[model samples]
Target: MIDKVAWLHLHQGQVLSTRSRGKDRYYLPGGKREPGETDAQTLVREIEEELTVALDPASLAYAGTFEAPAHGHPAGVRVRMTCYWAPRYTGTVQPAAEIAEVAWLTYRHRPQVSAVDQSIFDWLHDQHLLAE
Candidate 1:
């Protein structure tokens, strides 16, 4: 299983998502944790790297976890995504580094994201946190 951390930035009923340089599917803005790094640390770092915004470590809240088949990978490969809600951050958000596009995606855009992110969209929809 590939363990990863992601930021759940919901605003106006849409979530922040990113598409890598050559990828078609969008994903929540975060990445794998480094050695000995906490979830918040990983999230802060990943978000900063991908979104060019620094997440306030102290403002992160546990969102939820989801596991699903890793998209574009060999069959049977799975990914466990630990998600967080970052209420505060510094700087502006933009597509940075390997990111090619940044978008605000709604639940209706589920089909355009990875499996793990689809699960997040489903959950958010069920909770009415995501707009139709």
Candidate 2:
């Protein structure tokens, strides 16, 4: 299983998502942890690399975890995604590095995300954080 992390930034009932270069599906921001890095460190670095923003470690809060078959992987390959919400951050979020596009998505956009991200959308909708 591949372990990954994601950032959840919600605004006006929509969630921030990103599509990487050459990728067809949009995903929550953030990425895999580097060796010897903590989740907070991973999140801060990944968000900066992908979003051109600085994630406030103090604002990090555990959101939820979701797992599903890894997209574009062989059978039996799975990804475990641990998500966090950072309400306090600095700079304007813009696509950077490999991020091809940045979007604010509602629950109605579920089909455009990965399976693990779809689960996140479901949970967010159930929590009333995502507009129907």
Candidate 3:
């Protein structure tokens, strides 16, 4: 299955994350795409809905895509995560809607994230963007 996600970097060397409502682990601040939505559309909409920030369409960069076993899904099911990196942004971030808590995460605390998010953390670390 396809899952569209976004990775927002803060000026403090931390990445934005959300504790999904009722979930134990934290995740990147994004969600699945709705019908008739393009990847960019989904990313922009999801981030706005979850973070209450406006994403500049031109600033969104395609980082990379990752795949892993879907969380809370039947065994053998996988999720293909299309992740993007937005190095610049506008507006303050806040937890909205289904998001219970919002925080910035550093590489030292990467293990606290979900499996999919761990993959993202590794990628960012490899790119030398994550703080050691």
Model 2 agreement with the true structure over 8-122: per-residue lDDT tens digits: 9999999999999999999999999999999999999999999999988999999999999888789999989999999999999999999999999999999999989999999
Q: How well does candidate 2 match the true structure in TM-score terms?
A: 0.98
Residue pairs with backbone overlap in model 1: none
Q: Pick the candidate with the highest lDDT.
A: 2
In model 2, where is the ten-residue run with the lowest total lDDT?
A: 69-78
- lDDT digits (tens) for residues 51-114 of candidate 3: 8888887888887888877777788877777877776668878999899999888898787887
lDDT of each: 0.93, 0.95, 0.80
State TM-scores per candidate. Answer: 0.98, 0.98, 0.90
lDDT of 1 by residue, 1-132 (tens): 999999999899998899999999999999999999999889999998998998888899999999999999999999999999989999999999999999999988999999999999999999999987
User: Where in model 3 is the C-alpha error above 4 Å?
Assistant: none
Report the Cα lDDT for residue 129, model 1: 90
The Cα RMSD in angstroms, rounded to one decimal, for candidate 1 relative to the true structure is: 0.6
